[model samples]
Target: MKKLLAMLLVICSTASAEIQPEPIGRIQTLPDPYPPHWIVAVDVAFFHMNDGKLIVLDADSDDPAGRFKGMMNGTFIPVMYMAETRPEIYVLESFRARGHRGERTDVMTIYDKTTLAPIDEVVIPAKRVSAMPTEYYLQLVDDEKLALIYNFTPATTVSVVDLEKREFLGEVPIPGCSLIYPLAGRAFASLCGDGKLLTIQLDRNGKLVSSERTEAFFDADNDPLMEKPAIIDGIAYFPTFLGNVFPVDLSGSAPVIGESWSLVEGVEGGWRPGGIVLAQGDASGRLYVLMHPDGHDGTHKDPGSEVWVFDPQTKQRVDRIELALPAITMGLTNDDDPLLVTTNINLEVDVYNANSGEHLRTIGNFGQETVFLFHSDR
Candidate 1:
């Protein structure tokens, strides 16, 4: 009887410890009913500058799917999304061991898409440019094989990283130039301070194969091109501050400067180009330019009240989109029915039909100030 009681007690103890699995505190993921097209907005809080975040929103529903914060070292840094490869996002940021006064460690952190967790990180030896955030600061080249990150410690240089090998190769000096535009193969073009284009060709090992400079293309001081250009089929359409469209051919070995044309014709009160995303290109080779009336000097960064769609082939304004709110940046999805998305100064994202220019919806009071808007389809 004593043995029977002991065995029964052991069984009861085991049964008590094995509690029934409850639905509470369990992990579950429902199907994503939203469309695949995504809009990545880098929100750099002007007031709370240290609390910057990369917010990814579904273009179809205007719902945020993920948010990445505290990775940018309390500064506004550029982040690139790699959709073609193993599905990861790359951020060019700095880290200091002993706070702001310590030696800075420039690194690129790769985050997983599903969990938004850091999967890999590679240290960049060269100091990266930490001025205003621009997409040209970091770009993936050769079908996502190499990542070329621009560095500017007052002197221009590019840090090359082999993404496939997951290693930093080296830095290439680009004197008297700023910004990067990836050309055919492993070559890239930079905008020179003296109104010229500098093209640098690199071998697989990140060594300089050839470097060339074009003639002074645009007036850098009077009418400069915006850092962000609309690239389509190895051609970059640069919009000048005074509403001029400049195209540069990057298909060949050397840079070819195409004819420059004005975006506005005989407008009343000085219509000029303005906004963070001054211009964007669609898959059909149409260029979308943001325009503001009564623009003056130092007004290049102002919000645009109108969006003009133009065809680069014909150089004509095909359609005009009257924005419901003034936009500081704009992006477009590349789906069958493309959506023109714009972020206003009020930190709200306005979605519109790309073809009809009809207002679709407004999303976000998410308590973040957005600086740049990028489309996943790009």
Candidate 2:
């Protein structure tokens, strides 16, 4: 097996331009005949202007090229959708919209990754997707199940599908604002959005095991202003734009909010939290949080990109690194060492040292793709 060595150090700079691509690690490049030890391959969703497609690239080497590529040329994909499966890409399109034949439709397409072939398609009920957002809305409960979050219709249900068999598992009614996430040994579905936070637990057998609700709303107190909670080791850490980190431990008899700490001191304007990445770093069983860009200006601009590292145990911010561009979807190598991979809005994919925010190498160009999304290294 070939190995890559990349060292990352906490580089503090007054400006974000100091970081550049430099060789610090070795990436094993695999050819047409994939080697067993190739380890991980990266997938990038390319939305080229009106034409959208998915591109799968191998990150084993600097010049390692894309293994699979497909195009949706004239096809229309919904906005604000997340693809959450492996070897397959799911795209939810518009409702009552004309397809190639001008037929009324609301459809989600599942494409095979290896062959770039259409495996199956799911048609959503017309009324369910007519809500305010008007986007093909859904969330992945896991690799298999998907919680369909639609609008207006109370009869709307979570459409669960068996990814392996490529069939519908079942549908369950989960009304209100709910965010579905894969956690621990099951799926964590939190119905929040409409003031109250109602959490439901789903077992591996596709059954509802238990349900709970928070008696209040997320406000200035208790660091309730965070976007969402990310769970690590059965513990959910909530980070807010107000610069507070709320740690909630759910491993006990009753879930309780454990510790709260201020991450950024007097953060001007507010701190907009981005993606949260957690991995076991040392022998002490400690986990770190990867925070995205934050600035004094109250803007959700694309260029506001920064990576902040924090000790989840202490709930304190330890290191901060600024990036050239902001990140959308990110992943980490599944090994003892840490290698951070991120796809940015600038249509570029970068490999960085997870511990020390150092840019090692970059792949691809962004001007070709209007939008870009990514999945974990598989």
Candidate 3:
């Protein structure tokens, strides 16, 4: 019996060694510029902040394995931005020499879009915001020639770097404002604490040329607008805590504040916009907002159960998409036919047809926390 068992085991091991994978040392690469329908979901990994990840999924495919493009590391609550002209992905991240307790170093790591590998890194200030990552934090302005990194050490300031020269230019102090809103030519704006927009203009050398603030646009104490906005063709559509859209035209040197409109007129259930990513826009110039029922104080950060679609031109609710699951974060691709990407209540990623308002499928949870979604061709 022992001899027979030995013989069987030897035969099984010999057979397994005979069949080997055919491909030998072949590396796979993604397209130079990713498809416009691709979605990049950023996971902050609250359980373990040191191991953050940025997952890329193909929204056009329903297959679990087939739609997964690839992923890259987003160490330490990194903020991401996709480059339009270059085939590069920029991540503003921080590192500690002792794995969480040493001299902290922050850098702008430039990754190759094709290989999904870090190609170069430009060192910046160590004061990058360590809180929740948002779309307006690290913005590329000045025709994508300059990169602005938002910093907060209990005080607000912006660090400007010349991406073309790969050098840190200087820091601009924005003491009372928050978030970066790119303006026309060498300028950007931020929302002030007093319900106003402060515009900052810079020169070719990245030095501050002028700064101005608009009159109180909205009542900050009573009704505050969500800093996140859907920017379409240089117009920012920002939603208030209640359900109103405030349009700001950023096509000129200074921001032109347009009239505000209500989105929940005649609608029921007390629907109001709320979520980490409150609003997004599709390629057809339509606005999509995450909404929840029975909204109240402190409910502004709650996950939304429905998505309200509206025509920016008409400012009317065209369609409302009932979410398959409550979503905490949301994003939309910039394609003609777009896919609504979101991180649901269970931390899972869900895809829906933007035009038809159909629940496509859920991609399952990729990490402990996915707070932001980035969309673009690159």
Winner by TM-score: 3
lDDT of 2 by residue, 197-271 (tens): 455566555566676766654564333444445455657666655456666665543355565677666555445
Ranking by lDDT: 3, 1, 2
The TM-score that candidate 3 achieves is 0.92
**Residue 277 in candidate 3 has what lDDT?**
89
Best by lDDT: 3
Report how far residue 34 has shifted in candidate 2, in Å.
Answer: 9.4
Which tens-of-lDDT digit does each residue in 146-174 have in candidate 3? 99888888699899988888888988999
Residue pairs with colliding backbones in model 1 are none
- How many pairs collide in each candidate, listed in order? 0, 4, 0
Identify the superior model by TM-score, candidate 1 or candidate 2.
Answer: 1
Q: How many Å off is the CA of 24 in candidate 2? A: 41
| lDDT (Cα, tens digit) per residue for candidate 1, span 252-296 | 656688999889876676888888887887777788988899898
Runs with alpha carbons beyond 4 Å of true place in candidate 1: 1-34, 62-75
What is the C-alpha local distance difference test score of each model?
Answer: 0.77, 0.48, 0.87
